[model samples]
Target: MFIKGVKILFVVLLFYLMTSTSTTPLEAYEETSPARRLHKAHALCTLNKSPPATDDNDNEQIVETFIRCMATKMGLWTDKDGYNAKQVAKFFNKHNYENEVMTIVDYCNHQHQQTNLDLWAYESYRCATEGRIGAWLEEYYMLSLKL
Candidate 1:
């Protein structure tokens, strides 16, 4: 009788261990789901301005929109006084890319000087994604275009 009781207890303990160690479907899905990954990527993508659409699954369109927006700001949004380096610095600081301010400014300045808006926009996207997020964006979201 005592041995049977011990066997039942052992089975219950095993069941408890198995259930406790295993993650539920929802928990497992949340970890590796595309939606979760996209959410993280989107945070960096639209860090400043609003993208074309919040729920838009078209990554290419979103990136193009962002690049165009940046180009416009760099080219057309300047004051009569001229380009605002402080504004650029503040923008990078906002996105936690403070160290990239000088690099981006230099890159965009070169493009702006060349008077090529198209090249400026593409280069801006490349320089912006040059940090830790670049690889992930390139591989998963295709945010980096071959230039």
Candidate 2:
């Protein structure tokens, strides 16, 4: 009976955590912390390194074309170059995902205005870390095509 009560308590706590997840990284951090946000981004990027989703008209022919398509998922889906990783990376950098992460980290260290609900978006700025995001995405898409 004691074990059953503990199990029920654990389930209730887990549900609260999941439902309480913030809509933004900062908001999430406000409830949690910046370290958690970074960990989340890092996890997301790493997970994305796997194969991507497929479209209806996709062909199983050339590997390069398919790979490029998957790599472009992080893109705005409106570029003329189609699946250009360079352009996508540029867009984020110029706009600000990395900056958002840095800002969060800054707040985490300095205790400034900390909230994932800031006006800016992490996806707004392209990644500025040596093509890390783009490369990971490209590689993942390529692998996905093979299987």
Best by TM-score: 1
User: What are the per-residue Cα lDDT tens digits for candidate 2 across 1-147?
Assistant: 344334333432332343234344444454333234333443444453435428422212112232223233334222332223333334346345655545433333233222331101121212222244434434543543454
Candidate 2 residue-wise lDDT at 30: 46
Write model 1 residue lDDT over 4-89, tens digit each, in one string: 33433343233233333434432454754443333343344346644355543343344444444433443422322223444545
Q: Model 1 Cα displacement at 122 (Å)?
A: 2.1
- Taken over the whole model, the C-alpha lDDT of each candidate is 0.41, 0.33
Q: Locate the minimum summed-lDDT window of 10 residues in model 2.
A: 117-126
Q: Give the Cα error of residue 118 in candidate 1, in Å.
A: 2.8
What TM-score, over all chains together, does every model reach? 0.31, 0.20
Per-candidate count of clashing residue pairs (backbone under 3 Å): 0, 11
